[model samples]
Target chain A: MMRLRLVTALLASAAAFVAVSAHADNLVTKDRVGPADAPKSFTLRLTNDGPTSTDPVWAEGYQKLFSEFIQRHPGWRIDLERMSDNIGQEQARMLEQAKSGNGPDCAAVDSFVLALFKGANVLKPLDEYFTKEEVADLFPFIREGITGPDGKIYAWWWNTDLRVLYRNKEIVPDAPKDWAELKAAALASKEKGGEGVLFNGGRWEGTTFDWLANFWAQGGKLVDDKGKPIFAEGENREKFLKAVNYFKDLVDSGAAPKRVATIVNYDEFNAAAAAGTAALFIGGNWQYGQLKNTLEPEEFAKWTFSEIPGPTADQRSTGTGGWTFGAFSNDPAKVAMCAAVVKEIYAGPGNALQQQLPTAAALYGKYDVFKTEANETFAKALVNGQARPGVPIYPEISNQIQIMMGDVLSGTKTPEAALDAANTAVQAAFARL
Target chain B: MPTTTAAAMGAAQRRVAGPSLARRIEANPFTWLVPVAVMLGVFYLYPILDVFRLGLTNASLVGSDERYTIVTLQAMFENPALLDILKTTAVFTIASVVGQQAFGLAIALLVMRGERRKLKGMVALRTLVLVAWVIPGIANGLIWQMLFSEAPFGAINSVLRMMHVSPVAWLSDPNIAMLSAVISNVWRGTAFSMIVFYAALKAIDPTLYEAASVDGAGHLQKLRFITLPQLRAAILVNSILVTIQTLNTFDAIISLTGGGPGRATEVLSLFTFNTVFRNYDLAGGSVLSVLMLVISLVLALFYASFMPRREVSE
Candidate 1:
């Protein structure tokens, strides 16, 4: 009787353990998208904006597209990780993780830093996944930017953004076409008891990239054909100096407050707008989505964007930037699946929902949302948009430029002195590399 | 009876086993420290040694081309901004240490006076001061950033605007930005020094103050002659510790000014961080890390000099 009782207890324990294991499996598999009986199961670890993102609109759009993609691909699941809101930190973290071989299978990388990853040789090239016809559909700059030095596509440059002067239609009815008009309008807004124009004057890439448009409008190049930084060299130096001086004039004349030097992120610009303190600001085209999400409908409607004012009325340019996804999976099947995921998010309906201008020019024709007046303005702006060079040295150059801006704008150093110092630093870094 | 039983059992065990291995091992006090030594070696020594090792190599966090070399160290020292960064670090450390010590000592004296006089709400005051210290450094930075926001809507600027005064660039101007960072750091760190000084004050005999009062020594005189001299060791020790702490301040400054308005607040810690993470130069960052470790170690020796000496026997 004792033996029979012991045997029964052991049998009961084994049955309970099996039941718990089956329940655990059910818990893991529950709420999965697509067909449950699909033969293949693929899980993608992706780092991008997701449900936990601080920006609700961006998060919602990303989450929706990811779910839709998983539903389309049977037995697929995505483990989404929220990327860092700070661009520099995110890029650095991605590069560090890539070296460790423990990073996510796919990561949302800034387009300009794709070269750094390519140099690391951790990203799987996507040339075979994307066809020639598909590649040709991308913007010309993006087509060039996404391809590594070895003439292989390692990332999908899905969407791009343009920097522009966002103004309140009620306060500033007419767009400023030049630096002089911009300053005049900003001062006029200040006189009317509203804060003047604001831009990213803080120590970050935005300070360099947004202002680079002014230099580019004058046909200035940051680097030469050999990817050598020449922004502070002879002719380019003159243009760079002129551009920085204009920024100084704005701060010195109080058209834009000296405090504009504290603005680092677009969310700050949006916050100023939400407070109804800012009459005009320089921000990205996608800020329209952020503004819409942050402001009441009528308030958001009162705002619109225009080309970033150049040195003169006829000269026009704006800095273009965008996010890209670099696949790190070695398996070709996973790489192809990651490309499909990128397509579902960027090259298709996701672009329309996200409201970022898609890199594929045909998307405008496919999605009516791209034809809106605001997006059309952005599209026109893109004609003169210039993306930062996809070189490893560009980050260092951008850092030096950020410091130079802070110095010149804050009156700590003159534009000439700041540029010379910045040039020296960049040159030394370049030489070391 | 229980104690007697344990003692007898111990004696019997020792006699029977003739100081068995376990018994002999426990007999030496150093055996008790073996675990702690192992922990220190694994956690502290190994990582620090690795930092020095990496400092001698050309390693990158982003690339896999590490090699043993001195070029990274040379590059770090040769970099033009190194001098500026070091100078900024010195200014930041001095300002923060001075501010924390002064404010901490003042608050501690006030609280001690309150307690001696049987004043109400002394506990509340202590807790309130401690709240700042309890807040995480990053949160403190963010809180201060909101308060010092350059925008008109910012808490400080809003108050200034209400008085019809022109707004101040609290975080944009280079000098003012550094001052702002120092102020924020002092606010977050003062509580620590206050607690230390308060405890040291407790150890002072009350009769000293009573005798000083009878002799007609003023409050300032009592503080100078009695309190300060009594706290001399503590002040020195606290100074060294706070200096090291201030040197390692990265998160708060990073969140506050980002070492900016043009590298004005880029202390050694921020420089090391930016080099490793932002510049992707692990070896270069390691060199900076080693420099900081040397500084801390020097300060640690100074701290040790103030500690009470104890005798050891073989």
Candidate 2:
């Protein structure tokens, strides 16, 4: 009787195993798309690439939009995965996965990486799905951010960003319009017992961006028209050296904290600004939104934005920044669908206008201007805004720039020595390109 | 002569028949090995083989080329940032291991020497030490990070201000970041070494100590000779374990430093992670991983070969 019971149990287990195997085999893969008229079910994954806690309002806004998307697209499911504020790392991971031929059908990628992936043929060109008229309707800077060297669009801009000088109104009634005035303000703030100005002087990619914008304002070009790096051996070299020297002197004179060597991310510096410890900070516009959420309305009112001070009185410029959504599938139909989705999400009439209006309102609220006024100023500034050179060797160039800046900041190398070293490295990097 | 040869062969057969080799091992040895063997196969050998396979493929996010080459290794050597990372890793590992062992052994000796009146509290204190070890590594890093925050709101900075002292940039300064990581790790890991030493102390025969005491030996003298000699085995094992743990530690450093302030706290493992995950240079990451694996294997082999063997009495 015991043997018979054991046999019965074994047979039952085997039958259950077979049933499970069949069920698993029948499970639909995420990449499988059904016909339009057929019973369709799908899951879409989204990554926010920012901290969820600091921006609860923005997270909730995206969540609501996702729910609305699910309702609009019947028989489809979506799962949004929020990553911490490390968009560069996320883009690198997505790019790696795409090279392996198995990646997310769509991913939120930074504008810097969009060009790299497009050059590598890992991104699907979106020109076929969106017409030129529709593309032209986007903010020109946003459109330019996603355009490739071949003049094909590989991604859609989700949001746009630009660098602005954030100042404490109590410390300085008027924002400085040039570098010399800014330096004076910093010194004055320090003498008055506040951290004068805080730039991310740490060795990271952003530091290079901070340096290059100033260098460009001083008329320093990294590469000449012949595509050769020229910062070391010409009249332009002196201007680069002078700008860097001034920056170093400011740090050395206690206009900024000695701990500038340690600050890795803008958030840390921004925290100091919010606490009213720092007098001025150069940061992105999203930071204003972050400050709004973190500080009381009264504390928020202490801050305002202006253009970064230029080399001379006349050459002020903001550095343009944005993020892009790249499609990662080789399947034509899937690629087409992804492109359609990006357009629907970013550039559709209501969505595009919605994105613009909120950002403009947020900027105006913080800068103490009307939304219309802020929008017009922003539109005019876009013409003068400079994007980082879209070179494949940008990472290598960035590293060199950071190292050279580190030497100057540490007072180990003069500006001429540092810029010369950086120029050599830049030349090498471009040679690789 | 033939009869003599047959007798000799019978004697040899009798020796073999007394017990088969397998039966002798089974009769005299432990049974815990069956589960251990299964676990080692599943967790260690299987994953090692997977890593070996991954190392061979040129699989990257940017290309479909699966052909293996020395390109990754070349990249590893070519990257200039690796020198600073190696220095940081060495400093962190050495400091953490030495600190944990010294503090752990000292505490173990104190508990062992204390009078019975103090024994309960000492045991309770040891239990408290275990709490830091029991907490997840990332959580420990986060707790320490909060303690080390440079802002006036931070615990360390607040205390400094109350004492009329200037606050230090504990995480931001390159000179202090690795040391701070070591302190956090030592706090979490010392408990393990302490427990091992405690067990070793308990295992030492009470008669040996009593005999030494009868000879009019002082407490320090007894510890120097009897306790130290008896605890050598435990010390060796604990050292090996701590070394391996310290060398491979990732979560603590990553959560604390993120290898920032210009790669000031980056270790080999973090460098490997950045290479593979951040830079998509899988080949270079694999080479670094392989180098780390080889170093670990050599250390393990040296420990196994040099460890003093136990003897049996007749």
Candidate 3:
């Protein structure tokens, strides 16, 4: 009893000390972003993806961006939160909170899944901040991608990401011109004691993107000009079936490891690439910094990025995916401030400062990511990067596709059977909605 | 008239002396129950009721058309994957629980024997066995996942390659993935059964084993006659608890497999999680959750039936 009393008293005193210190600290700092004389004050919540201070160079770039924002808004205080996980899950969580009127003032949302939140009325329209012409100035496909069915822009697209083929130059010096050549190259590489390729064939959005490039390359469409499911019709079905079949063959034939179906994304691939284990890797461009840190200089230099190789030489296709700022607050004043901060962070000045691609057309050339030789290819390849199907139910469709691809790659199901299953599942999802 | 006079006198005395907390609680016995009742109503009752309510509706997270509907149930009934999913769950639970318990019993017996014989390294063996249990579930999953991962860096594959043996697809194959998950789970969970069985072993009367030995009973005969009967209650309790635990196990599968290689390792818990969190189908998730709760309840009832008629006077 005496020991308990002493511990309890200590805890109470510690709590009191912490409370007093916090209060004193808050009073002294006041989280200043502007001059004391500035009368107006707004807490603009800014969410962005960038490196931390430990990543000195990238972190310095982010600091420069934030400093620029502070200079632009003399009276506003910005609280920036860097989302540290898969931003898709973050977007879902943010939307879930918004439904209950419990959300941050602003957040970065994955552009592909933005429609899900927008359809649920979790995102506020940004018409008050961005003009119609300004929205139009965004790459037409991207603008259409972020626009809701109500024809309102709910998010400001930041720079987008493209899935591309990364290869070891020494192992397979020339980039394969087409799928047949790529397979041949991979097989030859395999003969020399190397894993031929690494790709995310797991059940995830990553798998969906992996399949999407192939589907689009083959001139297949999930939905037609009328926005109806058209794969059940004439040529699309055959093309889609072929794409899925080829995907299976890529794994089963040992061009890609059979274990590819279990790799979620980029986990083991990073280490494997740094160690020079795999000859080919298909992945997002975000890992450039990680590779630089982990890989030996020679190994890093041996790597190059190109458009995802296709079934035919002329078919250059890939999927563009990335994050954007969306306002989550319903308070008109807070929403207004969110829009201003978000716009500044992703467009004009902020775009020019950060390493990621800027969504704005005029600011595309000003990106730091474009300075690298590989990024130059990435930038040019962006033109071929198609946004995923812009629909509220796209996540469901993406899940079905992942399942279909996974079934073909990992299970006993034939490609045709898996495609039929996916079609039925997607149709069921739409019907339920 | 006397009652009125007595009541008046009591009221006058109460005005002079305020009721203490204990006195007030004694006067109104229900007051003592209020906090517990409120907690149950709020935390326990409300959520269960809400789940039932949600299960009756097509309650999706993304839409506002949440109405009284059985679409979720209809879909569940029509799903061709239901049987396969159920089979996966059953296989995972039975395989994990049975394997875990049997292994646990062996370890317990070994440890007890070690204690009697003063065996060297026995303590270290126990610590090694418990390492998986001591680590957090997610961390345990990661350790096993790396061990099972294919190719050059994976622990198992690395060893196999060293021996000039072909590396097996541990997690990628639909046939192998569930077994891999179960293996990881057994590694993490056996410690619980070990501790339980150890205590029961300790509680067994030493005289019984000594007398059996004196009567020239062999080791196996002693185990069958003396140890098995004495361990019946512990075995029943441990078996049921571990089975229920296995049925509810999701973390290892989630971290190691995420219920894939095309949903091959997808247990009921994982399926429910994918529906609720990934698909955002709240009603469907609720139905799955309710089904799980019903199974747990049945197990609980079964355990209750086997409970001792009187207090287990251990």
Candidate 4:
């Protein structure tokens, strides 16, 4: 009789615990900036660089805003964790956690990596939480990039970056207007005891981005509009070969560093430019701000941005890439809260303007507070920028490009053979896709 | 007469037979091992079974398929890059283990021979080496990365320039990245071998060496015939441990190089990681991991089988 009573008591407590948990899951904080009161108070597990005051000044502003948000939502809590800077390692950790039936409610993912997460089904679709009107407010390119081929927006984005040629105005009074002129200028710079141009050729996504866009601007397409690999064909293959040859010449002539094979990313290139070792570099808008903040004002002013020279005299092109916010939970109310937060962070009235302008000013000392002036010009150039291929197989294709470029830079493989091999690998990737 | 004879026979048998099986076990005192046997069954056996089950399933980061097939194995083979990574893994594991053993044994011998006053310095050095081993692998990787940074202002380049040597791209060049990773691993691993060897050396009999010296056996002959033979068991154990540790190393390579400059230093583990997380090919990655597991098991078996069987005793 005593054992039966103990068992009954245990059952009662288990039932009570379940009831309390359900109740807690349904409780919502009403102080948010959205119309409807969400019926849940979610603990969103987000990955950010730790809560520190050492971030760039603009990042500090965002942090302050985030803190204010926490204060406003008394019933809600965001449990943020600092993730490793290595994207590959972080993804592996997240994937391992997810396999154990526990995953973060949200994550900050790079735009290029969205497909990786989506293919693994680690991302939760944001469509149910957001309306069509809300989706329309985001930039079309960003929206398109975040949405899967199945038409679900798996992630959200705020920050945008694009690659442009940064030139030393003191060294070159007039920047090169086209590919031919750029080559000549680089050679001349080398003869004058300066590096012609600097960019990464290390095997990574960055190298692929720089190489593919340059190849594209020269009328070389790796894949056709129908998503069929075209680089193995007659004219396209020849164009790719020619472009690689030109890149090789630049390296061989000491116009670009032979150590390009060692440059893993834009960070190294940025450091070089800051030290006055490189005369020209290809980098993003964020780099301009980085240089302004890290280098002295006098040295920083010597730098100015220009379009990446293209094949034709008048044509120029650059590569656009960015980071995005992603939801990883399927709870409706939590998803709604996250969607609202993203809207506030990215598309709300003054967020983008505030992020771009003051950050540009305080960090880089380059201010165009009015969007109509220099900011508008910068935005126009970015709008014309080409994004890396939106295909799910892009990583593999990117690897092929990096390998080919590394071979070219290292003088291991001829430009024609490297392009041919890259073309073959890309074709194989597309076939699998 | 018959009853008296039977009684006498029974008494004689009882005297000769020591005890029954249960009584013998109780008297012998080894019956206490039952709890240890139960603990091993509960802890070790259960986990091994669970892992084996997981390995056989189609479970992945994505949902699992109901059917089981050799599809995963096939995918592992289809990836042409796996061979290069496996080759790198072999080179790193072998070089690191061999280097650690040689250096560790030498240091252990020196520490054994040094005077008591100088032993403190050796102990302190050993402690410092242990500190490197105790540091998390991720931290070690980052510290090495700072040392190998290709830029002029990087630590290694700065030192090289000061020495009037051209700066080397330690992590960037394919030829150097693997070597850099091996060096970092060796630095962290040699301490473990040293500790093991030092313990083995401490347990050696001083009387045997004294007797050998009295018989006019020289120092080189003593090391070759006596010291080395005495430490054989410890050497075997340390080599096996270091081999396993070095073979499974992924964090150092990932943190230091990210297996880049065209996948120059990508070991097998990193390749499996890229397959599952980066490429989202779960089955393929699992097959690769299973293959790596098989390789490790085979290596363990080989080590066990080939280890010196003759036990040395004074």
Which candidate number maximizes lDDT? 1
Best by DockQ: 1
Q: What is the TM-score of each candidate against the true structure?
A: 0.89, 0.78, 0.87, 0.79
lDDT tens digits, residue span A209-243, model 4: 87666677766666666657677588887777776
Candidates 1 and 3, the one with greater DockQ: 1
User: Candidate 1, residues A172-199: lDDT per residue as tens digits?
Assistant: 9999999999999999999987789999
Model 4, B205-239: lDDT tens digits are 99999999999999999999899999988988887
Over A1-433, each residue of candidate 2 has an lDDT whose tens digit, in order, gives: 9999999999999999998655433332222222234353322335542212244554444444443443456554333344445566667766766776766777677766665687667877888887777677666656665777788888877555677788888887798888888888988887767777888666566777766778778667766655466666687778778777767877888776656655556786567866667778888665776777777898878888778888877887666666666777666765665665565544332223333321222233433233445455555555557767554555556666666666676565677766766666456435423
What is candidate 3's local distance difference test score?
Answer: 0.77
| Tens digits of lDDT, candidate 3, A71-160 | 676565555455535455565666677788887777767777776777888888888798877787777667987787788788888667
Q: Candidate 3: where are CA atoms >4 Å away?
A: A1-64, A67-89, A131-134, A224-233, A348-354, B1-30, B118-128, B303-314
Interface RMSD for each predicted structure: 1.6, 3.7, 1.7, 3.7
> For candidate 3, what is the TM-score?
0.87
Candidate ranking under DockQ, highest first, comes to 1, 3, 4, 2
- At residue A422, candidate 4 shows an lDDT of 70
lDDT string, candidate 3, B64-102, tens digits: 778998888888667666687889998998898888888
Candidate 4 DockQ score?
A: 0.24
- What lDDT does candidate 3 reach at residue B151? 57
- Tell me how each candidate scores on DockQ against the true complex: 0.53, 0.20, 0.40, 0.24
Output the lDDT of residue B167, model 4: 90
